[model samples]
Target: MSWSITLTVNGEPRRVELDDPRVTLLDLLRERLDLTGSKKGCDRGQCGACTVLLDGRRVNSCLALAISHDGAEVVTIEGLARDGALHPVQAAFIEHDAFQCGYCTPGQIMSAVGLIGEGQAGDDPERVREGMSGNLCRCAAYKGITEAVLEAQRRMGQDGWEEAA
Candidate 1:
């Protein structure tokens, strides 16, 4: 049986048909939607490579069923930029060298975005690290990731990004 789901992705409404209910959100985004930024690391929730924003909250898309998120709003790394300009978090990531292999960059960015939006990514480096602990970097890029999150938080604060809705 096929199940159809409607989701607002990257500020655009998308209606997707799922031939299998077991299809994960990560698969839906990468395979069907052509949004391959969210990687398939462990194919399990242990890795944050498939992190995405579901209704403004970060979730492991690999474990999220596409059919269960009907009418939900989803955002991937592709949606973080506007008019060819990078988002604050993306910019900070670049400035701070938050990535090495770049395979986990997209998920890290998305998780950072969601963290900042949730107002959990505070100014403290320890706090940022704690909040971002879920995202593992095989290259040991935690320092840069923490720095990026802190810097992004500062930049966003200056840019008048009030608490995320």
Candidate 2:
């Protein structure tokens, strides 16, 4: 039986018909919607490679059933920017060299955005690292990642980042 799911993705409302209820949000976003920024690393929830903002919270898309999240607002890495400007996290990531292979950058950036939006990314680097522990980078860019989050949090504060959240 096909199921219909409506999602406001990256500020655009989209209604999709799911051929199978087992399809994960990641699959639906990538396969059906052509939003491929959220990667499928482990295909399990262990890795945050498929992280996305669901209803303003960071969720592992791989673990979320598309059919269950009808009417939810989802934000992927592709949606983090405006006209020609990068999101604070994305800009900070580049400034801090937070990515090496770039495979986990999307998830890392998304998680950072959510963390800052949640008001959890304080000035403490350790706290930022703890909050971002779910996302792992095989390239061992933890230092840069932590630095980027802290920097982005500070920048977001000055730029009125609440709307992006």
Best by lDDT: 2
Report how far residue 84 has shifted in candidate 1, in Å: 0.8
Clashes of each: 0, 0
Q: Give the RMSD in angstroms, all C-alphas superposed, for model 1.
A: 1.6
lDDT of 1: 0.88
Give the local distance difference test score of model 2. Answer: 0.91
After superposing candidate 1, which stretches have Cα over 4 Å from the reference?
162-165
Candidate 2 segments whose C-alpha is farther than 4 A from its true place = none
* Alpha-carbon lDDT, every model: 0.88, 0.91
**Residue 15 Cα positional deviation in candidate 2, in Å, after optimal superposition:** 1.0
Q: In model 1, what are the clashing residue pairs, if there are any?
A: none
Give model 2 RMSD, 1 decimal.
1.0
For residue 46, model 1's alpha carbon misses the true position, in angstroms, by 1.0
Clashing pairs in 2: none
